[model samples]
Target: MIPTNIVVHQHSKVLELSYDGGAIYKLPFELLRVLSPSAEVQGHGPGQETLQTGKRDVVISSLEPVGHYALKPTFSDGHDSGLYSWDFLYFVCENQEQLWKEHLDKLALAGLDRDAPMTTKGHSCGSH
Candidate 1:
């Protein structure tokens, strides 16, 4: 289900998506940034994911439509690679709570904090 309306609430730091049947979702900027599907965040394969940190204050600087299938948002932190697909957005909206819990669990397991600064790490591929 594609969102009928998309609003970037700068003050609230959320991307509001309105769908049919009066369903609405407000995705936080931090959530979007941390869970970005881009390779930079997700990595090239399983177990290679890069955990995102220090994105609590991230903001969407611009939002662009990607051929009617997705949205490309340029974040204030200069991240613009993730292309959020319609289905992917819907899934995130529906599973927001669970996803957040899982993310927190991972952070705890890694002995990391969400507000901590992201450290520069070398990737196996030798590429950023």
Candidate 2:
């Protein structure tokens, strides 16, 4: 179900997705960036996923709709490719805690932290 309202709370760095059923999800910008569905984040195939780091302070510069399916959020750090589909976004809202934990685990395994400077070199959206 597509959200009835999408509010980007820049001060708090959260994206609020409100549904018709009154479900509201406050997703952090960092979480969104890390979980972006683009190939840049998910890669072209299994086991090729790139670990995103140092995005704790990332903010949404803008949110652009894509046709009738997803949103393209331009991040302050210059990332503007991941297409957050309705299905994916709903999944994110439903499993936010688990997804966040997984992201943290991945970061830890890579010896990285969200607060660190983004230095891990890897593709991150439509080509640079």
| Per-residue lDDT value at 31 in model 2 | 94
**RMSD per model, one decimal:** 1.5, 2.6
Lowest summed lDDT over 10 consecutive residues: which window, candidate 2?
119-128
State residue 32's C-alpha deviation in candidate 2, in Å: 0.2
Tens-digit lDDT track for model 2 on 7-78? Answer: 999999999999997889999999999999878778888998888888888999999999999999999989
Candidate 2, residue 7: the lDDT equals 95
Number of the top-ranking candidate, with lDDT as the measure: 1
Worst 10 residues of 1 by lDDT: 119-128
How many residue pairs clash in each candidate at the backbone level?
0, 0
How does candidate 2 score on lDDT? 0.89
lDDT of each residue in 1-128, candidate 1, tens digit only? 89999999999999999999999999999999999999889989999899998999999999999998999999999999999999999999999999999999999999999999999886655654
Superposition TM-score, candidate 1 onto the true structure: 0.95
Which residue pairs collide in model 1, if any?
Answer: none
TM values, all candidates: 0.95, 0.90
